[model samples]
Target chain A: MNPKVSHPRIKEFEVVTNPKIIKLLLDGTRKDIVFNYLVNEPMTVKQLSDAMKKKPGTVLHHVQKLKNAGIIQLVETRETPRGIVERYYRAVAREFRLGISERMSAYDDDTVASKDRVRAALLGLSTLGIHISESDFEHAHDLLQRLIDREAEVAKVYDSPSNHAFQSLPPSTRYDVSYRMSQFLLSQDALYRKTLSDWHDLISHYLRKIESEMV
Target chain B: MSWPSNYPDPEDNDRKPAETSAAAPSPSGILKDFKVGFTLAVKNFLSFGLAMLGIILITILLLLLIVLFILIPILFTLGLPFLIQLVETIATGFQTTTGLTLVMLIMFLVLPILGPFFVALGAIFGMARELVESDGTQAESAFSWYGKRGLSLLGGGAIHFLITLAPLVIAFLAISYPTWNPPSDEELRVIIPLIVVWIILVNGMLSLTYPGIIDGLSAVKAAGRSVRLACQFPVRVLGAWLIITVLVTIPLIPVINEVAFLWAPIIPSDLLEPYGALAILTLLFVIVPAVSIVLTRIYMILTAKVDATYTQGADST
Candidate 1:
């Protein structure tokens, strides 16, 4: 933390983080995937593990870490077989903005490793794009069309000067919108990757055509 | 080998601390109280209005004489510093004394001339609260309390004004320190301590003034009581004020801005011109008064929770 950064005065706004919270949020398949799942609603450890196809103990450990960070909270508890308790967790904050200044200051072994993993995943996806089927390309296009349609509707409602409906809206509204977008992106994860590959191929082909025409 | 029961044992309940009687008054009682209070307020307003009319006539004449003879040069020399200091203080205490005075002056002057219009509005709200609660007749109870404790309420208001003024004075003095050309960061570090002290003192002053007004105590006694109460329950008082401020101001921003905009265009440019003078007077005498009543009602509701807490404490002890 920067020495100039003042301690938050408001109790509710104070950000608390621990190794557990970082592990819960980041030490997963993908940061975006874990975040999007929790954004929808509170989910129990077992449910999260089953949905993500991860071990229950690993999910429980990560959930505890996140709880300690104050990023997520134990919203409710339910009784189960043999009097076992099931705790449901929900995200406290809807969004997190990792600024360049924070990233620069936060250089550490774990962060470096996380960065490398992200790079490797990108490389692997680029390699896999060559094998994508025609059906996958069609599905990707359809998903993109749906996304554009949804966004157009939102822009129409929001962009009007006379429309006071969402003008001066509360922070909660922005959080909800962000959460919805994240869920949409997560649901179309495969399609999004395919779309990226198709765009890359088209750009390459256009450049090659321009070079041939010049010759 | 004890069997489980649906309810907890009565003996165990005795071990728990006694719950405070913080329940709101029943609906009918609240309405009855409001009715009695409204009638008494009307009587008071009429008498006050007659007295104010005479005072205003005299004051206007005196002001005219002073402006003609003495005020022009004096106002030119003293106006800047005085106005700047006043504006700064008002801005710092935006939702506090500055705002309260603006509201009260409007209410006190305007409501009487408007007659039953504002009084009916006040009564409707007071009565509705009573009806919702389904309580006993509170009209007489409300009037009797205000009538008997009028002096104390006035004193409480005065003390509140004075307490809020103290920090502004300190801040003004601090501004003068830089003029003396302080030498080092060490000298500047002194300001940090002063700011900390001011926060402690101001918070202490306000916490006391609130309960004092609601309970109807002398300003001096209230100040002392507030200091002690604040010391004992700093978190509670701070939390209450924070909650009240956020709750009241957050919702009222749009409404207040709308009202300001509507009135701003009608305000006169020149205080000297006859029509201009009349425009200014009408706004001050009429429009402001109408707005103040609604503002006062909001204040009353915001501060009601604090009063309830004090009442509950009194009931318990």
Candidate 2:
């Protein structure tokens, strides 16, 4: 044992630079498979199918596609009844980075406005043990869209000015300074601030609602 | 990476894999831990800080009571003279020879009772973990394990405390070596620095000892795991340990009142008696909780990658 290197764990992140892999991940079923099921821990086809309410055959097909793309890997296998073996698979990384492009629009219609992103967010919230009612979900979706639009408006106003100043800086300094400037500008933006406040209020209100129901 | 020939089977879900493909440690991750730790500390300052203050005061009272419990009987047997001597010693301050004996008695005799308090401090880490990883935690959660797991944590605390004290005792012994043939100046210089480094390194290695106990390991097992973690991520663990050590030690700086390091002590020395009760208060209120949160945060991050058994194991408590 080297004794210096830490424990055996899957890589933390994988950058999807290859266009083909990006396209493969764009498919809703495969994206769902990676994000909802396989991202954190290994799961068998039977478990995945049961969780997603899909047939094992269909889920296995998507899992195979993901496995072939090198986005997920078979990590373990277990014996089942009748001498059958079930393979457990997990994402090759805990997180996937869209490294090829600044925007995921290359693979989808729209990245932020897309329902897929909201669904993915909800799935993430569910993993955190948060499940909201259908009506609450709709309200959340609307509030999120408003926040997105306000953020876009704020960016449209500041991006050009920030980019022009960033261009004048030395390349090495630009990478570090631009992030700081963007954070500062966002912190000072009123519309963005109000939108964030509204978002916070909505989330906290839901949390309180959940707490009340539990009580 | 190919598995080592002697590696245990990966199919054994009970044990973590002994593979080497790990997430490389980065400064940003440690900084994030710092930011989270400080932020949580600031957010929960009143609740957690007061609780910690209460614990410290209670521990001090318990120690004094225990000392007196032992003292009154001996004093009664010796009659009024010893009582007068104790009062004189206290009035003259602990610098007096008789007072030093009392101090030594408080320090050594109360050692057994000191372990559970460190385990009690583990409660701060517990609350911090809950706030970060799950739903928000209440201040009262700090005492949740007090009555139930008191004995086990006392055992864990004793082992941890002994490991922590061993280096200090060794250093003291080395420095106070027999004077028959005292060591030369050069040898003393090398030995002193080595002892300091050894203390720091030993502490860094055992940084996660309490967290391991909090995660349900026995004290011995926790100490062993902490050493393994230190060996595995020597740089990260030591970096975190040093950062935390420096932060906690800041208020204890001798010149805080003098402000001697500054070109001019712009803030008046009397403004708040710069390093008197204010320093102790800051140490108790701000620094201790912040250090706990930071240590717990780093422990969680490192353990998540290294140990599969860390399903936030202490949550069940």
Candidate 3:
């Protein structure tokens, strides 16, 4: 009578932490590339291999490790040669949280690894910001800002009588407006990230110049 | 609690699954069903337009108020160095999760209650619109479905929330217990089992609750029906969800990084200037709600279709 008893597969999804499980996830290089690519979004193994410049067989090995870890999952698949399938992988969690601060705690002085991670994070952040900032500036900043403000204001009015006016507009129109806003935000973000990256580089250059003078 | 006798008897040797009168709809019949559904949705939309607008407006205002309430504590706690540092890091890493949780809480808990009230109002206006479209004699005022059906709708929403949350509440308790006092290895041993239990409970709850809520059935009755339907056709429900998730996730791949960057401001930043700060705030206010609404609509459409199919089967029986 119990639902759990009735559905055994549901019970099989335990947190797999074993090294063997990790090995299983990274078994093939193709799978590994696919899993890494999916840390951003779901990607077909072909897309993964193409991006990584690796053979499909190689990529599949690593993807299996990610799958076993419950870190990457099959989002979907498409048919290919001889009815072979190509599955898309997506990371299970969107965000990662470290329980303790790695920087503050004592650990191996892997400065190179740390530096690489920091650089990647910074670059990622800067690229995203620059894109958004550019989009924001493209449409006269004031005009776009006003439109956003108006939408916000309209969104605020919640009296009983105005519901008719709200409903009269097609749902698609609302969706269209929202979609445009998201696209705009995305562009602005890209721009912002780029700008930040430039600023960081400039700051670093200046700091180096100051250090040279001090030396 | 037993399977309904009216269920198509698979064991009957004489009758093939395909031979049943209602086993599968003809293409024309499918088209007709679609047409009817579209009409109903349109009617519902039109009649409830004003009420829905009001509900949305109120809901948004309430959300802003809730956000303010949540933020005030953080601002006050910022005076404490430890708390401030913790908040800063969480803000950076968990921006999307925080935003999503806030949005989900508002949508699932608040919207459902307000939604049916508006729907009833819409149904009344929709009937009036139909009469007008037909060139029938117009009455000064139409019968209000809200006045007649408000209680049932509100009751259904209440039941929906409670039934849906039961599993989540249990999962939360299970997950949080270990965190209060760090678990020993023996206690950690139980973690996998607990997680598995939690996933099954959560998924099963979601699969069942949406249909039950839409149908305005009591939680027990809805849950019972859902369990029966899910067990009868496990692959169909799971496959439907899996396919939907994959399809939805595909379009999101290119944009995920962009979305995260846009949302990053909800976390505190020492490096960003006043202008940069303002831009982030503006982005959050404008974009977050829009994205949430679009996603919610997609979910409704998918779940509603699934519910409608079951309703059709029930009607045939």
What TM-score does each of the candidates earn? 0.25, 0.47, 0.27
**Tens-place lDDT digits, model 3, residues B6-87:** 8775673421222112244234322332333333334434333443444445556655776567667867866567667866
For candidate 3, the per-residue lDDT at A141 reads 32
Docking class of 1: incorrect
Lowest lDDT 10-mer window, candidate 2 chain A? A77-86
lDDT of model number 2: 0.63
| TM-score of model number 1 | 0.25
Write down the DockQ of candidate 2.
0.01
lDDT per residue as tens, model 1, A56-167: 4345445645654566665443323211224456666555433333323344567545554332222233342332222243344444455444545555544465756655
lDDT of candidate model 3 versus the reference: 0.41
The 10-residue segment of model 3 chain B with minimum total lDDT is B308-317
Give the DockQ of candidate 1.
0.00
Q: Given candidate 3, what's the lDDT at residue B244? A: 37
lDDT of 2 by residue, A1-215 (tens): 11212233888777677767876876778988887678757776767777888655456557767876899876643322211224467888887765434224343546434546654454346444455443466567666777666556655654565567756778678657655666677788787778778778877877887789889
- iRMSD of all candidate structures: 24.4, 18.4, 23.5
